[model samples]
Target: MKYRIIELSVLIIAVISVYAGLSYARQAAGGQTIQKGGLVADVRAKKIGDIVTILINENARASNNNATQTNKQNQLEATGDFGNSFLNNLSGGVSAQTQNQYRGSGQVSTSGTFTMQITASIIKVKEDGNFIIRGSREVETNGEKVVTVVEGVIRPGDISRDNTISSSKIADARIFHQGTGVSTQAHRPGLFTRILNWIF
Candidate 1:
């Protein structure tokens, strides 16, 4: 019985020594642990607010023993700017043209009465490349309610293989109104003018 107890004690000590040695070796080899708060560094040339692209690499072998390191890449894009003048004008302000390019994509999803001011322009690009746009705008209004807004996602497969209606056009104007209501002067001519036309 004493021999068995002695053997059990030696086995326990050996296992504990092995565990401590492994832990010490790992620390000496720069085994950095990735915690929940571990954030990758930002390595982008241009950045605006929360919209940023980070270039990063992985080193899982350092913390995970015998694990092959696998690098992962993620692309993130976010925008806060609602469509400005271009959209307002596109719907109907000057020329009238209907194209699905900028139809009902983005939104401002706000629940309040406020005036919005903005500037806008259209851009064309090829199929292959890293392209992104981020903007934000706001107006003075009462924010008594919480609102959640989302822009329509445009995927690569969503585009048409055959390019049609590639260009954009202006919108139209509203009806002619002289005062509070629509002006009926042109439709119903003055009595004097009617008499003059009959006499002529």
Candidate 2:
């Protein structure tokens, strides 16, 4: 009976020691929370009011051309002779010739390209883990100003570790670019020219 009691006591002591060691280890770990995939959680721009870097490597090109031409020509000739008579001799045979021509041509061409970069901030976060961002940038030099604005939605997964995303990846995007200054004014027609064009 004593031998059995000794075995029971030793088993209880071993279990208690193991439990105490496990509890101490847990406490020593500082109660760190583990992510679903065992990855250390990071504070990324996944919420509203978060600032994100937008690597605006954007480029666009457009071109158009139109041409038209027309040409027309017409000619007519007629000659008449009266029956042999004195009247016919007095009034020489009648002759007539007529000609008409018309020509027209027109052409137009246009093309443009743009590239720029800007940073943006998150304005809202959707239930599906998407972010809505809006931002603008302006550059001025020598009295000339250029403004660029962008607004759109983006998926969190699209953002890189550095919290940057390409403008092309944005969804439902609205982008605008405008310029104003002496250079822009020089490209436009004068007031009188514009008035003439409108009148015509």
30, model 2: CA deviation in Å? 12
Name the top TM-score candidate: 2
Regions of model 1 farther than 4 Å from truth: 1-16, 25-30, 35-134, 142-200
The lDDT per prediction is 0.31, 0.69
What TM-score do all the candidates reach, one by one? 0.19, 0.47
Q: Write the per-residue lDDT of candidate 2 for residues 1-200, one digit (tens) a residue.
A: 99999999999999999999999988767555443334444445877788777776545553322333323333444446567755466544544443332222322222354556678889988888899999889998777776888899999999877678888899998877666775555545556655544543
lDDT of predicted model 2 = 0.69
* Model 2 stretches astray by more than 4 angstroms: 1-43, 62-115, 187-200
Highest lDDT against the true fold, candidate: 2
lDDT of 1 by residue, 26-114 (tens): 88665454432243332222222223211111121211112122222333333343367454544333433321111111122223333
RMSD of each: 30.4, 16.2
